[model samples]
Target chain A: MENREELKQLIARIKGGNTDQFGVIIERYQKLVAHVVFKMVTTEADREDVCQEVFVKVYQKLDSFRFQSKLSTWIATIAYNTSLNYLEKKRVPLLDDVAPQESPLERIAAEDNTPDETAEYKDLSALLIEEIDRLPVQYGTILALYHLEDMSYKEISQITRIPDGTVKSHIFRARKLLKDRLLAKYKQEDLCR
Target chain B: MSIKHLSDKRIQEYLDNKLRPESLSPDERKHLDSCQLCQGTMADYSHLYSGLAQEERQLLSPHFTARTMAIIRALEKPATAISRSSLFIAFVAVVTICGVVNYFINIKDILYAVEAFSLERLLSGSAFVSTMEQWSSRLGGNLNILVFAGLLLILVGLIDKLLVRQKANRAYFMSV
Candidate 1:
């Protein structure tokens, strides 16, 4: 997290035609941008393109930044919007709810080659990642920003343009969804271990 | 008083440390401390929280920053080459030249001169079209200069186009 004075100095230098300084900003925030882009975009090539596009846009639009929010929040907001636009262009669904055809865990189980394969793998973290990927785009994005990036609901709301209360609700629902999916797939003892 | 098991929300909140110790009721705390089921649920959520924090971030290629900087550098070169001030100056020069030309040969006068030949007379072939004849004779002398200026403008436009396309190509190559 960059303080206001540090961010101002960095941005001032970049706007003063020292574009190399912008690389520093990119290095610092690429992980933040990647978190949002990776969750929203599934393809590797497209993800790389969108990530590059996000930084390019940030540099181009840096002059208009009013510093109303943390630079990270602003950068995350750009990443989120750029990813959404890419998805829109690709005609991918940005539906908020999980598809009703099957429960998320059940869907994951069905995809496995063997019913006991997940248990045999014994890597709950990897299993959770798979489950998260199966969620709706919005849920996956919220989870990544909230947990991986350690963003607060308010910061996420600002980034996603969701209401603060709705952001909290989404986080709660997304977590419960993950927990339910994991619990349904494995015994309590197996998961607790 | 009998205390039911902890709800999932309560367990989650507890795991998140959102429920402070003082906030927990005596019965709830006692039950949570003693109950195996609630404890197991807490362990599962704790596992989830830590896993998320420790999840590996997907990284861009190692050359990502260098590639992006190259694109920015390419973009900036064209931008510095053709500045807003230069474009504004060119625009002002065109407008000034047009204004000066308009002052000397008023388009309104030309239109008025054309209207002088009434349609009725022209249809009847009785009119000599003196007004149009006078304007054409006047325009004929300046036609060479006008053509020269028009060609000059076209050449400038083509040069601008080529420069822009070249800049675009350079940037595209850098991005690759």
Candidate 2:
């Protein structure tokens, strides 16, 4: 609460045209912004670029902020919208509609002969990352927020502007799809053996 | 007991710990404990959970924070600078336009006085003709040149004003 008050004061200063105060806000929320952006964009390079764009937008629109939500929520919202705009500009297709069943896990498992080995686990982790990359933007986003960032469902709902139930459903479906893919990979590896 | 009857979704919920342990009916726990297939499925899910837990906390390179901050700073500097320049340019444009319009409106009164003086009739007709001819030969050419030059100056000023405006517009919208 004390921090929130300080943030509001800083935001007031920023909106009043002290742009250096805006830098303080950026310094504070940079990690949260980067994490959100990283989940949406594919490459490290793009994520870095997008994170900057998000902050730039936040800085430009500082005066318009009505203080209806938390500063972090506002920043995350900007991060989310900026990433979407970046994706749209890049002509990248949305991830939700296509239900590609083929899992990257299958490919990784096929390449490895050893089961339950650390190398196999590492390969599985890599496969998970690839599969996450392939997930629809919405699914990928929720998974990242929930699993990677350890955000609560309520927080995710706030960030996503989706209902909590909807967030849960998407997460459930995403996990099921991921599991099916991994299990199928394991079976295929067995057949090869 | 057909383990096949258990829904993938229900098993997932159990594995995720989303289901309240207190809310689970006795039959559900019994099935989970007794059924090898269900137990095996739970084990697989636990393994997957552990794997995800281990993998999710990936940190970027050590320089990632510095690099991201740098890019953000770069993007922000240009954006704010551009917006500030545009606001300044817009302020100048409004002032200039107001000044030009004021000048034209004030000059219109003087032009009206000149036209009214030119419309007066001659007092002596023959004398007037001679006078008119003299005026036309000497002052008329000079007047023509002066008026033409004045109009040209006004036109050039307006055009220059417009060009400045266009440059500001281009800089504001195009460069960034």
Q: B139, model 1: CA deviation in Å?
A: 12
**Candidate 2 steric clashes:** 1
Report the lDDT tens digits of candidate 1 across residue range A1-193.
6888988999999999899999999899999998899889977778887988899999999999999888889999999999999999988786656534877455655665453555554677777777788677888888889888888888999999999988877777778788878777675335334
Query: What's the residue-level lDDT of A183 in candidate 2?
Result: 74
Give the per-residue lDDT of model 2 (tens digit) for B113-143.
3443453533233354555555546442444
What's the lDDT for all of these models?
0.78, 0.65
**Stretches of candidate 1 exceeding 4 Å from the true structure:** A115-121, A187-193, B1-3, B81-156, B159-174
lDDT measured at residue B132 in model 1 versus the true structure, 0 to 100: 60
Model 2 segments beyond 4 Å from truth? A1-3, A16-18, A43-45, A96-98, A101-121, A187-193, B1-5, B15-20, B53-176
Question: Could you tell me the lDDT of residue B17 within candidate 2?
Answer: 71
